[model samples]
Target chain A: MASTGAVTFWRSAGMTYNAYSNICAAIVRNCLKEPYKSEAVTRETVHFTTTNWENGIQGKPVTHEIFK
Target chain B: MAMAAMRREGRRLMVISPTVSLNSTNAVRSPLVSQELSLQGTRSISTQIVRTRMKSVKNIQKITKAMKMVAASKLRGVQVRTEQSRGLWQPFSALLGDIPSMDVKRNIVITVSSDKGLCGGINTTSVKVSKAINRMNSGPEKETKYVILGEKGKVQLMRDSKKDIEVTISEIQKNPLNYTQVSCLADDILKNIEFDALKIVFNKFQSVVQFLPTVATILSPECVDAASETGGKLEGLNSYEIEGGDSKKEILQNLTEFQFSCVMFNAVLENSCSELGARVSAMDSSSRNAGDMLDRLTLAYNRTRQASITTELSEIISGAAALTG
Candidate 1:
C-alpha cells in the first residue's frame, strides 16, 4: 500500500473496482498459506486488496531499469 | 463468280487448319483429350470457380502474413521485458520452493492464456497443464479452485471443470499486457476465503518453434515455516532478520503478497510471448499452405483450359474433314 513507486496500477476502459479487487483478492488467497491466515495476516491483505491503485501500474514494458 | 468462290474457299481453309491440328494432337497423344469432349460444357464454369478460389487464397495469405509480422514484433517487445523482470520473481520462487507445506488440501490455480484464438494450442496446452496438476495432486472436488484469466481458457474449463472455475478475467489481450493487468487479478486473489497454496499454469515460451506448458507455485509463509521446522535446510534463513513486533509477520505477509503478484505477472508475460510466438509460427505455416494451394489451383486451371482448347479443335477439325471428304 505504500507509495514505493515500484507498482503502478492503471485500469482499462471499462474495468470495475470490484473486478480489480477480486483479482487482487484471488492473488492474496492463493499466496496465503494455511495457519498464517491469522488476524494480522487478514488485516495486511485487506490493505492491499481494497485501495485506490489507479495512479500507476507501468503497463508498458521495462527494459532499461530492469537491472537497476 | 469463280473468283469470289476461290476467295471464300481460302478464308474457310484458314480457320479449318487450326481445328485439324488441335484434334489430331489430342487423338494421337493421350486419352486425357477424350474426357475433355464430355466436359466441354462445364469448362467455363470450372475455370471461373478456380479463379475465385485463387483470389480468396491470396487474400487469406495476406491476412496471415500481417498477423505473423505483428506477432513477431510483439514477441520481441514482451520477451525482453519478461527477461528483465525475471529477476524479481525467480528468487522468491526459489525460496518458497525449498519451504515445505503443512496443509496441502486447498489448491488454487490460475490458468494464464490469451483471449485470441488462431495461436496454435497455447490455451489448450495451459488447460491441459492445469488438469495435469489436478491429477498429479489428486485434488478433491470443490477443494481445487480455478481462476481463468483468458476467454479461451475459460471456455475450455467451463465444459469439464465448470464448478471449479471461481473467477474469469478478460481484456488483457486488448492491449500490450503489463503488471497492471496482472494487479487486477492479484487484487481479486487477496480477497479469497482460504487456500493452502497457489499455482499458475502458463505456456513457457521456449522458442518460436517450441512452447512448453509450465506451472509455477506460490508458497505461503506457513509452508516456509513447515520447511524450516522440519529441518528442510534453513540454509540462508538466519541471514535475514526482522527486528520489529507484529511487523515481522506483517512484513513477511506483504513480501509474499508482492512476490505472489510478481510471479503472476511474470507468468502472464511469458504466456503472452508464447501466444504471439505460436501465432507467428502458426500463421507462417498457414500462409505457406495457402501458397501451395494457389499453385495447385493454377496448375489445374491451366490443365482445364488446355482441355477445352483440345475439345474445340476436335469439333472444328471433324467438321472440316466431313466437308472435304
Candidate 2:
C-alpha cells in the first residue's frame, strides 16, 4: 500500500508504462494491417534473474543475459 | 546479437551521414548564410532551445505525475478484485500443488500481461520465463504451447516462440477487467486445446516498488485424479458425492471450466495490480528525472544570459573609454 504522501507525489509524475506496453504488444496484430510500418520499440522492460555463475549480475538486480 | 546490433548501428550511421554531408555542402556554397552565424546569435539560439526543452520537460513531469495519481487511484480497487478472485481459485491450486511431477504429455503456458509498457519490465519478465519454459519443453514433438494474453506478451513471444503460440488475445485490459471475459477465454481454451498441464505466468504485485514474475500451474484432470486417488488434499473433493453416474464427465467439465476461469481471473487481477504498482513507481522516477533536467536547463539558461550581458557590458565600457580618449 502506498502512503498518502507517495500518492500525492505520483499525481505529479510522467506517462503510464501501460500505454507504451500496449502499443508494443500489438505489433503482431498490427502486422495483419495494411502497409506494415515495423513498429517495434525494442527496449527490454526488465532483465532476467541470473542463471550464470561468473561475471553475472546477481542478488539485488538479478539480471542474466540468457539467449543473447 | 552484439555483432548484428553493431551492423544495424553502422547502417543507421550510413543513413544519417548523408544529411550531415548535405549540410556541409550548403554551408560551403552559401557565404551570406555563413556570415549570419555570429557567437551572440548562436548563444541566444542555444538559450531558446534550452528554454523550449525545459518547457517540454515540465509538461512531461505534469503528465507523469497525473499518470501516477491515476494508477494510485486504480490500485485499491484492483487489489480488492485480486483478493476476491484469488479466493475463488486458491483451493484448487493448493490441491494441484500436492501432486508430484510426471512426464507431461501436453502443456500450455499462459502468460497474462497488460497492454501497457511504462510499468518497467513487468511484461518482459513473464515473457522471458515463458520462453525459458518453452526451451525446456523443446524436444521431439514439442508438447508446450503458449496462450498469451495482452499485446506485451504476444509481441515479445512472437520473436522466439512464434511457432509455439496456440492463442493470442489482444485489447484485453481496455476496460475494467471482469470474470466473464476471462471465463469466456477459459472456455475457449478448454474446448480447443489439449493439455495435461496448465502453467500461468503473471506479474505478482509484492509492493509499490517491487513486482515478481511468477508461474503458477493449474493441474490437468489426470494429475487431479492421480492425487485424489492417493488421498492427497482430496478429502474435500471426495465428500461431494456425484448426483448421477453419467454426469461425472459433465461435472468434471463444468468444474474444470469454473476452476480454469477462477485461476485466470486471479492471474489477470494480479498482473493488473503489478502493472499499476510498476506504473506508479516508473512515473514517479520519470517526474524526478524531469525535475532534475529542468534544474540543469534553468542553470544553463541563467549562465548563458549572464555571459551575454557581461559581453554587452564589456563592449559598452570599451566604446566609452575609446570615445573619452
Question: Which parts of model 1 are misplaced by more than 4 Å?
Answer: A1-68, B1-45, B98-103, B139-142, B233-235, B245-247
lDDT digits (tens) for residues B177-228 of candidate 2: 6554555556556656778778888988788788878777766665566556
> Where does model 1 sit among the CAPRI classes?
incorrect
Q: Using lDDT as the measure, which candidate wins? A: 1
**Two-chain DockQ for each candidate model:** 0.04, 0.01
TM-score of candidate 1 versus the correct structure, residues matched by position: 0.70
What is the C-alpha lDDT profile of model 1 across A6-58, one tens digit per residue?
A: 33243223333435454575567557667754532333222111111112221
Per residue, candidate 2 scores C-alpha lDDT tens digits across A7-60 of: 322213431222223334455545654444332222212222211111222123
Tens digits of lDDT, candidate 1, B185-214: 575675543566788889887888798888
Regions of model 2 farther than 4 Å from truth: A1-68, B1-46, B96-102, B230-250
* Docking quality tier of model 2: incorrect
